[model samples]
Target: MDTDRAAAVDPIDVEVGFLTPALRSDLLERWNEPQRRYHNETHLRAVLRAVDALEADGEAFDATEVRLAAWLHAAVFDPTESENNERSAVFCERVLDPSAPVEEVARLVRLMGGHRVEVGDLNGAVLSDADLAVLGSDPETYDTYAADVRHEFAHVPGERFVAGRIVALEGLLERKSVYLTRAGRDMWEKQAHANLNRELGLLRAGAAG
Candidate 1:
């Protein structure tokens, strides 16, 4: 039997309840953890809203799965830990949908690491693009986000963080397009590039100083 193909028939069973009250409370607790400055409910909601907007205006497949991915994508965020995505994906897989393509859910969650998706994978494209929509945010919003991110990594020294941040920004700049969905590409690609370049320049100058 083609299990993967059969599971694809129902991408997201949104109507089927999954997030219990206990689960919701646990999720909120993690988001509200003291160590988190940026990967909190606010950022999660922003990504959720971005997904909503994308669904309303663009092509998004397996939307329920994408929405669930939004909830759990940053669930294990830790500035000091490198396995946040992997850890989060594992947890999400266990809870997302057992009968469905749960591993597929994990795959999408893992993609949050680089925000990269196969060209034809709309589920991945939508989720990844929505997660990165912040990059295309207006200057003021983007600045606030940057500040929040630095706060998240508060344990790190300013110089070290800035140097690392510049490296990350430069990597983003090198991407052909950070936002992969059609809506993302049309609405945010140019703005995202401009934002990335501007930040990289500022961070580079700061590092030099």
Candidate 2:
């Protein structure tokens, strides 16, 4: 309920600032698609807010490129499609302002699909950390996010969902550090780990039951 439930994407949605009105509308419509739950406009706003938080924390980055990446990271979301990021990057590259450093944003959005920012790429670090901020939300918020994500993938059978979700969660846990930026790590590392472990535990219990 973060946005008006039936809010239409105005061609000038400004959510996609700098893009032509038509491209802005298209991007917003993608975020507003009925199929989405967690990856909706609300999630888009949250990630943008995280970008702002990063700036407030004094994190150095190519601000324009990072924010541009944030806006388009989930532009072509398809829970069932592994190539959504690549697709999203293509769409972004096609529509982004010619002077906006397309290659950098494309790289950030592509790597962001897995939250795997390249080491020392501060722009990527900011975008990746912003994308993962939800992982460190409080239990109530985290639970809500988890449920919304499940709903988004409701097409998957329950067992498959559990299995796929476990592999994904464990993959994140296996990472040496889930958040790359120092601020991100300082703020989210421990809590994010706890949240992932807790969810994995619940999924296992459900599988056992």
Candidate 3:
């Protein structure tokens, strides 16, 4: 099992370093919500770790803004809802520290809606790559992630879940490159393509079966 379970973390978790205690607690509450499976604290920690890894690998960006955006990017997730990114951005605006780059952080949070960071958007690129780093995970880890995501939408019927998931996976496959930052591409792009293609094949096989 993935070691970073939400149950293992305290509600007052301060692992993200830059957030205020109050804001961190609130964000934890939102992320650790019972309905969350894939988007839980585990996902949040993975993204933050990816951000740190990208920086260590020489991907330059404003660390504070990107990390802050990472913490709040999915702060309003709901498996049944499509506007979680916008709602998360609104939540960021409502609670982020004034001294922080409020608008930039919110913009980064919003960008996760599509993971489509435009060129010249250094912060957006970093955040998008970090958020998507899970795609390049080893096969075992990627399988676990896929299963958790399926559980997140357990409310949906299996047929609907398979159909929607196929579309999402195909969309990523169609992208020229899954990761925006050079380090991200070097580290995860090929593996991400492999993982996505493998999952797509499994889904297609199941659908045909």
- Against the reference, the lDDT scores of all candidates come to 0.79, 0.83, 0.87
- Arranged by TM-score with the best first, the candidates are 3, 2, 1
> Which stretches of model 2 miss by more than 4 angstroms?
1-17, 20-22
Highest TM-score among the candidates is held by which one? Answer: 3
lDDT of 3 by residue, 1-209 (tens): 23356436542343554597778778888889999999999898888878877887889899888888988999998889999999999988888777779899999989999888889999999999998999999999999999999998898999989998999999998888888889999999999999999999999999999
Q: What tens digits encode model 2's per-residue C-alpha lDDT throughout 99-188? A: 778998899889977776667889988898999999988888899999999999898999999999999999999988888888888888
Candidate 1 lDDT over 107-190, as tens digits, reads 998998877677798899998888889999998889999999988888899888888888888878878878777788888888
Question: Comparing 1 and 3 by lDDT, which wins?
Answer: 3
In model 2, what lDDT does residue 13 have? 36
Per-candidate TM-scores read 0.86, 0.88, 0.91
Residue 45's C-alpha lDDT in candidate 1? 70
Residue 96 error for model 3, in Å? Answer: 1.3
Which is the leading candidate under lDDT?
Answer: 3
Which of the predicted structures, 2 or 3, would earn the higher TM-score when compared with the native? Answer: 3
Provide backbone clash counts, one per model. 0, 0, 0
Judge candidate 2 against the unseen true structure and give its global Cα lDDT, from 0 to 1: 0.83
Ranking by lDDT: 3, 2, 1
